[model samples]
Target: MNNAQEARRILRAHRYGALSTLSKKFDGYPFGSITPYLTDHDGSLLILISTLAEHTKNIQNDPRVSLITHDQRDPHIQTQGRVTVVGDAQPEPEREKAGQRYLRYFPEAQTYFAMHDFSFYRIRPVAIRYIGGFGRIHWVNMNNYAVADAEAFVQQEDALLAEVNARSSNALCRLLQQRHGISAMEAHAVGIDCDGLDVYHAEQTWRLDFPETAGIESITESLAQLLTATP
Candidate 1:
């Protein structure tokens, strides 16, 4: 695998992350929140926040933000590594598409969705601070990281997702409905990295990034075909 693939592997391993933003309520102090963010095809963050959410309000006041998601394991806790994303927050144009992608990974978000006060936010990463282990860390500049339009993920959502979600076919869909308690209406692709693909369903985002047998070119081609067929 390449550097991008390696970096993506570590990222897909963890989900929950702490997001820090400038506070709008308390004299602009630093405000931190435990948020669920989905990574898009090119590695940028996609989040859905309620308009009434403190972080959403804070972001409206100041778009700068950071998120830290780390590996959860024994010794790794001390320095297993956490990827920090520093970027700008802005409402995404593709709210419906993003919401579909996000809710799959976080099924519990159904409650949030029902409220109808939330809106989608997309992060455009300027730089990524990656820590491999204790004392082993480096900053990734834009050139080293992939920064594509937010639409890329949305545009490829349908077709590629079918392949990934269809792998286990009926069983996986049934499992999501029975065990996960998700209606599982449809599956959308929220993430695609050099390592694998992420297909969102309900509360559990299924990660398909098995580096040992991931085919980036084939997937890319499939997505390309789907887009052309979009009329």
Candidate 2:
């Protein structure tokens, strides 16, 4: 896959990142916090923050921020793929839409959503840094990194994933074992894009990228090929 596609896939695979902001209290020093993020179909980042949180305060003072997310594998972290997004964070004016997608990924946050103090913010990326592995690093322009046609599949994502997890459990397990050698007894599809499936296998997650990107219309055929491929 190209660097842009690889970076987008990595972002979709992991949900948490280290958010770095200019500290409001520390006199311009950088402050970092573990933050959970979800991507809008166009590649902007969505984060839920409480008014009382330090990161929220920092963002209010200065919109400039950066977030880095990496693969969560057990191997050496330095060698794993990672993506750093540099952007400005601002309150999402149309927050109901953000809430819908964020809640799907983090349902437990429903209580926080009900609270008045919490609100969603969208980060508009100005630049991106993607590192696939050693010697595979590059600065990707915004146009190259964002998926322009994501709208074609985002609305149907949840239902598509639900059907796969519910009726195609064995196919998922087979793909996981054949690709990663992890014979997971239980697995559920957590995310889906035109490119691949992200499966939550018990405590760990596995990303299964198709041989080629599949549009919404061809997803069924793409998945069927994997299920029937020689292991």
Candidate 3:
């Protein structure tokens, strides 16, 4: 529907990616790791990694890297949609704040989250390569592909997360039940990276993926209304 919607779609289609880093042991060899990434609203990936991991070591040595995310299920892999983000990889300083959103997406990493060695890394894209499924392959011009820093919602993350989980979540649940005739014991927010928030309701066993970057505040309200209206 919009840039944020399109960005959210691109991210949902491909969750895992190949994170290529310069090998510390080998001078010419590039190291690759399959990583489950969470995309931020502006398209940067929020990766959960540990200082003990090899990729972490590589990233520390050099923050520069190229990360590729795509669907491997396609019969013709090349025909499937793929996005390659080339950027600098570095540890996120706001671990305690962003960790909530990151951990929500990946609950299994809770143990690692507690460990001092584990941390969140953000891939700040310098450029991106987007290949639309089937023959629509073209590199989006930087002007259109990258959202400006001012336009990105990078401040007050902790507050935003808290508000969403509290005010938004409850309202969303009530709306779903009232308008959609949906009933559930609980609603769990499964993921909240950057571009959108993915929530799960106990009754439907289905996911509600809502785009937040476009207008996170407004989108949250719209989703609640949509949920309530659905039958």
Candidate 4:
């Protein structure tokens, strides 16, 4: 895969990151906080935060922010792949839409979603730093990094997930075992994007990268090939 796609895959595999925002109370100093974020279909991040939160207050004072997430499963922190997104965070106007997608990944956040103080913020990336390994690194080109023709995929995501969960559970189970060596009695497709699919099994989520980029028209065939190719 290209550096950009690899960077996106890393971001999609993990959920939370260290968010750095300009502190409102501390005179524009950098303030860091751990926050859960969803990698949206277009590669932007969606985060739910309370208005009363320190990060939120900082964002209000200045929208400029950055978040870094790395592979948590890797034991060697220095060598593991990571992606840092330098971006601007703004309130997402489409609350219900964002909530639907965000809640699927973070069901426990339902209570927070219902609260009046909580709101969704979209972090649009200005630049991305991707470190593939100790020596593999690159400043991902924005044009190549961004997903093209993503609207169709986003609109069809729910239906696609429903079909996979309802009809392809066994295949998904085998896939988890084949790709991740984790045998699962049941597996559910919680999310799908251009890069790959996210499977929830055994109380944890596993990422399965597609052989190639998949669009709405090719996703079915892409999945079929992926499932059938594995054992």
Candidate 5:
């Protein structure tokens, strides 16, 4: 796939990133914070922050921000793939909807979501920097990195994962082995988007991309087909 698509793949596979905001307290300097984010279908990022948070305050003063996420599986940091999203953060009024989407990826944050101090901020990306590997880096345009029909699989994710783990776990493990050459004793489906599936196995997360983007019905069919084709 292209660099933009590859960057989105990396973002889809990972859950946390380093968020940098213009420091409101430090004379407009950049302040960095470790944050967990969820991507919307339109390529924006959703971050939950408390009113007391430093980054939150920073964003209020200056909406311009940047977030960077890289592959953790790779030991050689310089050679690993990573993406940087430069954007503007604004309050997302749809808290309930954003909470539903965020909690699915970070269920542990439920308590935080219930608190009145916490709020959801949506970061609309203006530009993206995607580094695929050593010497394979390029700046990807927002239009090229956009995810179409993110809701296609997101709405059905919970039920779909339950079914995959219950009935197709073995097949998924086999598919993992077939593609990555690593055998996982047990695999749990953590997330799925139009482009790929995220499988948690052996205490690590693995991404397996589809041959093509998949919709709700096609995703199930694709997994079944992979199971039979893997051998």
Candidate 6:
């Protein structure tokens, strides 16, 4: 895969990151905090933070921010794959719409989601730094990194998920077991993009990369091919 796609895959595989925002109280020094993020369909990030949070206060003063997420499963941190997003964080106007998708990945945040103080912010990346491993690093171009036809995928995601879960759930289970070597009683597709599919099973999310990048028009066929190939 290209550096951009590889970076996106790494981001999709992980959930939480260290968010650094300019501290408003500490004379603009960088303030770091752990935050959970959801990768939006368009490759931006979605983070739910309370108004009272230090990062949120800093963001209100200065939207500039950066977040770094690495492969937590790897014991060797320095050489493991990681992606750093340098971006601007802005309030997401569509609360309910964003909340629906965000909540699916973070159901435990239900209480925070309901509170008035909590709100969704979208971190639109200006540039991305991707480190694949030793001797593999690149500054991915935003033009090549962005997902095309992202809105189409988002609009159809709920319906597509329902259809797949209802009719092809067994295929998903088989795909998970055959590919990841994990057998589970049930499996469901939580998200799908040009790069691959995200499956939730056994109380954890697993990412399955497609053999080839599949556009919105061809995603269903691509998934079917993978499922058919998996025994």
Considering every candidate listed, which one attains the maximal TM-score? 4
- Model 4: worst 10 consecutive residues (lDDT sum): 222-231
The model with the greatest lDDT is 4
Tell me the tens digit of each residue's lDDT in model 4 across 1-231: 799989989999999999999999999999999999999999999999999999999999999999999977778999899999999999999999999989888888999999999999999999999999988989999998898857887889998899888888998889888988997888899998888899987667789889888877898998878777746
What TM-score does candidate 3 get on C-alpha atoms? 0.72
Number of clashes in model 1?
Answer: 5
The count of backbone overlaps in candidate 4 is 0
lDDT of 5 by residue, 85-195 (tens): 999999999999889767766778999999999999999989999988879989997677876666666677778778877887877788789887887778877766677
Error of 3 at 184 (Å): 9.5
Each model's total of backbone clashes = 5, 0, 5, 0, 0, 0
Error of 2 at 213 (Å): 2.6
TM-score against truth, every candidate = 0.73, 0.86, 0.72, 0.97, 0.84, 0.95
Candidate 3 lDDT tens digits, 1-231: 443335335765455789999887787368999997877656678898878888888888888888887666567776776777888988789898768766666667789889988888999878777777676665656555554542335554445555566756665576556644677556654544334445556523233454344354454464454444543
Error of 1 at 170 (Å): 10
Give the Cα error of residue 141 in candidate 1, in Å.
Answer: 2.7
lDDT of each: 0.67, 0.83, 0.65, 0.91, 0.82, 0.89
| Cα lDDT of model 1 by residue, 189-209, tens digit | 555544555556644565544
Question: For candidate 3, what is the lDDT?
Answer: 0.65
Better of 1 and 2 by lDDT: 2
Between prediction 4 and prediction 5, which has the larger lDDT? 4
How well does model 6 score by local distance difference test? 0.89
Candidates sorted on lDDT, descending? 4, 6, 2, 5, 1, 3
What does the lDDT read for residue 108 in candidate 5? 81
Candidate 4 vs candidate 6, TM-score winner:
4
lDDT of 2 by residue, 109-168 (tens): 899999999999999899889998899999986677766568877788877777787788
After superposition, which runs of candidate 2 have C-alpha atoms over 4 Å from their true positions? 203-205
Tell me each candidate's RMSD, in Å, in order: 7.1, 2.4, 5.0, 1.1, 2.7, 1.3
